[model samples]
Target: WRLAEKAAVTLVDRLICDLALDVDRHSVGETYLAHRPRHAGGFEKEAEATQENYGVAPEILTQSQLSSAGLAGPFYGAMTTPIGFGLNPRKYVAGLYKGAFAAGTRFFDRSPVVQINEKGVTTSQGHVKADKVILATNGYSSEDIPDWMAGRYMPAQSTAIVTEPLSDTALEAAGWTSDQMAYDSRRLLHYFRLMPDRRFLFGMRGGVFSSVSTEAVARTKVVSDFREMFPAWAKVGISHAWSGMVCLARGRVPFVGPVPNMPNVLAGFAYHGNGVAMGTFSGQLLADMALERRPALYPAAMHHPARRFPLGRMRRALVPPVYAAYHLSDLRR
Candidate 1:
């Protein structure tokens, strides 16, 4: 958690310094509360230490404060920046793509890579070899290409749902006036944010497999959880529901470097759901490596070689049991 927090804060600081995009960031710190009283003491102590180290106090909010923030909880503590911020991801990516296109970057859409070697990639259109091949395939990577990459990371599923635009009165009724993004302190955590359009986006970690039935079950659970969290929005219709895979590495950190024994074949992946900033930053590091530029801003851990999963070919089959264990542990939390 410390490493993750440091990586996130560092990336956010770099973004702010570069003026990369209008992140729509807010300093309204996130609240971390639990329904169980046993969790409060540990959280309070941790929050206090974090506040002291970061110079941003983690206020121990009361029940009224938590309620006012649209959080359903027994009061605990809240941490401020550099942990609190919000951004419009769509606009950020769109802007980057537009700029890249203008800079004469020809995008070959729908040309899926069938094979990758040290030289280049063989796509659906045909084989077009090059001097170096950069494998940026994260969660969607196939096992066929570069046998070593297979089973190197666990691709876990994450689900999200968004509600129809709620009115100001509806927002107030839900006690959600703050624009800050919020998440709980569980291993299988729930993340949610109120969009500028008045819609609420809720997400969670579940759905070990990617299938219609799995997605349906995940959606049902997420919607139920959302309703439970914000009773005022219980009747609100869900506008969208979706799910995607997030690559998980052994150390919970991303890797950006040449594939072992295949130096020219550089790869960058395994962000573990922190792809928005970590992915972009890793892309830059990969580019630097390809271009033979200076060293990266991040530590060597960010560029370490990925450790292969022990299950090998049966890795995907083990996802369900792993998810169940994590879910059971979260239930205890």
Candidate 2:
């Protein structure tokens, strides 16, 4: 929390300095302090609206900060997938949009759309009647969503697990204190991060799961898959494992903002793993557009949901081969 907040403050300080063509970094810092002066008293601090950078924090590379810092990828602001959201989601709850308290209201069945509005939540199932409609469903989508949208999104499942707390010795070995979340560059990655309680929560792409596994059932072979990330738990049994349904898109980017057609009715879904923030950001945009209000501060071209994908079990069959080829390509690269 401290480091993230510090980074945010520094970012703005530097940004203002850059914007006005200030000469020195320290000079900008002094200006920032003067305008947004802080009193090291009993007051709470502010957080940065957004974070910058894509690589791991400097301190994290206890062994090599200087080199590792630059020997990395650019930040997409996607806390879910550091490699960018192509086929996977980031590890943590990098949610930018916190849903409104009025989430499950009756507003969905009306104007904005005639059928399958923002969410799959609706009272009617028959052919929807309205001026126009949009298919915002990503993975859990139904045939009811427009033919175009259905073609665009391919729903898939992902699994995640929070591990047993880390031991003091384990922490010493890992050497990371802050819980900055991280995920890798694979279509299926074992991305994870630290928690204040010292537990390492890990997540990855799991094949379809039809039934739920109890805690006892889940805890059976826990240490195997993730032991490589932290071999310290070789002998420690896995406390638990659980699975859930997550969506994936054609390119993995959320179909935010607006597109050419389907006016009055706006669409936003297919978050890939960027759903949290993307959802919030998209939802806010949707609400503003619906309310006939324009947000001064937000991204343009965000409400546009992707063009849908074709329906069929063909997706499932083709996915294995496609993903395998993709992974093989990665190996070669």
User: Which one is best on lDDT?
Assistant: 1
lDDT for each residue of candidate 1 in 1-333, tens digit (9 for 90 to 100): 344445555665575556566655543656565544555556667767887766566666555557665654333544333464566667767767876787787788899999887668889998777777788888888787778787787888899998999998998887776677777666678888887777888999886578999999989999998888788888999999999999988777788888888877888899898887778777777778888898537566766788887778778777778767877876673
Model 1 worst lDDT run, 10 consecutive residues: 73-82
* CA RMSD of all predictions: 2.8, 13.3
List model 2 lDDT by residue over 1-333, tens digit each. 223223334433343334443211211111000101121110122112222332322211211331232212211112111221111123221111111223443334333323444333244444444443434554666544443454566655565676678777766554434334555445455455555556766666545333555332323333455665456555554455666555666655566555344454566766665454455455555666667698644433333455444445455555656657765753442
After TM-score superposition, the amount by which residue 88's alpha carbon in candidate 2 deviates from its true location, in angstroms, is 19
Cα-based lDDT at residue 281, candidate 2: 52
- Give residue 36's error in model 2 in angstroms: 43
lDDT of predicted model 1? 0.74
The TM-scores, one per candidate, come to: 0.88, 0.57
